[model samples]
Target: MSRDTGTDTAGMTFLESTPKKMLNAYLPLGAFLFVLLFPFYWMAITAFKPDNELLSRDGNPFWINSPTLAHVKKLLFDTAYPEWMWNTVVVSVTATFFSLAASVLAAYAIERLRFSGAKQVGLAIFLAYLVPPSILFIPLASVVFQLGLFDTRLALILTYPTFLIPFCTWLLMGYFRSIPFELEECALIDGATRWQILTKIVLPLAVPGLISAGIFAFTLSWNEFIYALTFVSSSEIKTLPVGVVTELVEGDVYHWGSLMAGALFGSLPVAFIYSFFVEYYVSGMTGSVKE
Candidate 1:
């Protein structure tokens, strides 16, 4: 009877009781956040923990009572971590630049040039990205040896493009497709060359896609272990991912604190980069999907 007097407000209520909101959304999200962040929490605690506390079976293991800088000192001073960090930065940056350059040209050709079998070519290029690095590493190693690039950062810088190019090309093509062909047609009528159109108009508009592709390529290069391990032998030329794993552990012995410190430091740059460019990344993805 009361319900007849007042129409149902079910759709009007954005949220119900506090307990319902907590149960329906907050609890699940909180649990996911806890699971996701627990590793970093443990890593931070372990990195600052003294050897005694880390090894001891007593006291609270989750929290560090007395934090020390011993692990940080060891990671910075005793290890080739600094060199590894530098190598990672140089290789990742160079590879990303090269990949983006090649991908832009390739994507433009595939999307705007209207070449024969362009769609098929794009599909093939994307399929190349599906090829596992594990399978590719063997032949790539032979090529690296034959080219006399073994045990050098150049091998990684060059070979990373092989994989990076395909993915970046596919991503950029999607973005380029989202753009109006009318612009290019108008430019053609106005006597603008393809190079001028791309450099002056297309590239400027595709900045978000470029950033997304660059960030992806850089992150992949940073975290790549199989290729880094296969191509580079010197500890000084190793990437952060390879160096931390190979250099930190001895037979039946693990330098837990120093290892965790390396991991924490290694992850910080990527986290910072993603946090800064999240908006552009989202826009790029949305634009690509709209095509």
Candidate 2:
């Protein structure tokens, strides 16, 4: 009985010695979740809240007294929002596709070709990615004007690759490096051409990496403001980021409800994509390359 009693006391002491899970885990997690989700919650509420409630201070600021779809209706019917959505999708997808194709070729050549000054070329590409879009837009604007591509979706598609290619190349270089070289050697021994090896073996194995790069490029293109603002002047050709801010406001007056609605709606597609492929994104970033 005494031995059992001692054992129970020891177990109780061990339990007491353990760090507090509430403080170490749940508290931090809860706080992080609140911080992360608070903006979305605010945007959602603002999107739904009637203009009277949005401007009024009589009720709880966080809670919507009455919800209406008037703002969404205005955004959809009264503005060129649908066109902006279409433009955004077209530009983002096209840009991401071209960027990924170029990145795959560039990354593969840099990592596998073993050519002279390969490391220098890779480093230079990454350095180009580090260049600010704010600076590049000035020169890019000149080129866009010269090419007569200004205010066209084709302009965005072509220009987005300038930044997208470098970053995607850098990301894919790391992923490609993680892949075993033995596989390529074996393919070469089996009389497979470099093209066949890349298409059948390397690319198939690098789907996670490709998806990660695609997501990044797509998100960047989707949210791109400076180039979109600078290049596209017409409402019909403007992207979501540029169109929402430009068309929604008239001089000093701000349409908070419509603005929030536009932002919330515009953000949903990217959020959906990210959530859907988050696991692949994680693996790609972590370079889980298998033999």
Candidate 3:
């Protein structure tokens, strides 16, 4: 009888301790997930809800009634969403490719070459990134105007590189520094040119950093509002951020549902790209920081 009582007390104690331990382990994780996901959840829900339901005072925060596809349809058919989307794609893809190309070459030169003032040049490039776009845009506007690219996609594609290349060059330089030079030395001894070594060996090793730089450049162009807004004035030439905010919002009559829908859709491409290459993205970002 005493033995049975002891076993019962031990089992009860184990059960109580197990839950406490599990809670301690998972509570922070659960809270973090909720905080990260709640805004996305709200946006998705609000996108589906009808205008009347969205504006309802008695509507539940966590649940919506009378869901409709009107906002999605309007965004797709009744607005310039498609044009804006295409413009964003063009600008982002063009800017990203150019930025990556420039960054890779610049980073390779800075990392491999033992020239005078190389370190200072690299630092100056990074400091260029620190300069406020507000101050630079005025000067850039004159350059774009002189180049006959005003109110055109060329204006954005050309101007985006000025900002992207500097930071991206700095990022790739750090990443390239982390790579050992022994591999390149051997390739050089085997009659490989600098261009050949970069194309065949260094580039393959730096794929993660390249992808990271490309992703950063793409996201920067995609989300850039100030430059896009300041440079492009025509409705047909506007990119997503400026187009969505200015064209979608009618004075004080805000279309929250449609606006949220546009934002959600605009973010989908980037989200998909990031999700697919998340491992490389993480490695690249962390590796650059470490170097």
lDDT of 1 by residue, 216-288 (tens): 7778788888999989888988999999999888788888999999999999998889898876556544543
- Tens-digit lDDT track of model 2 for 86-173: 9999999999999999999999999998689998998799789779999989999999999999989999999999888987888888
Q: Could you tell me the C-alpha RMSD of candidate 3 in Å?
A: 8.7
lDDT (Cα atoms) of all candidates against the true structure: 0.88, 0.88, 0.84
Mind giving the per-residue lDDT tens digits that candidate 3 earns over 1-291? Answer: 013333455334454676786686578789999999888888898888888787778858567777888999999988899999999999999998988898888888887874788888888887787777888898899898999999999999999998889878888887788789899999999999999999999899887778888877787888888889989998888998898888999899899889999988988888988898776566555644443
**Model 2 per-residue lDDT at 171:** 84
Candidate 1, position 66, lDDT: 91
Worst 10 residues of 1 by lDDT: 1-10
| Local error of candidate 3 at residue 88 (angstroms) | 0.7
Residue 5 shift from truth in candidate 2, angstroms: 40
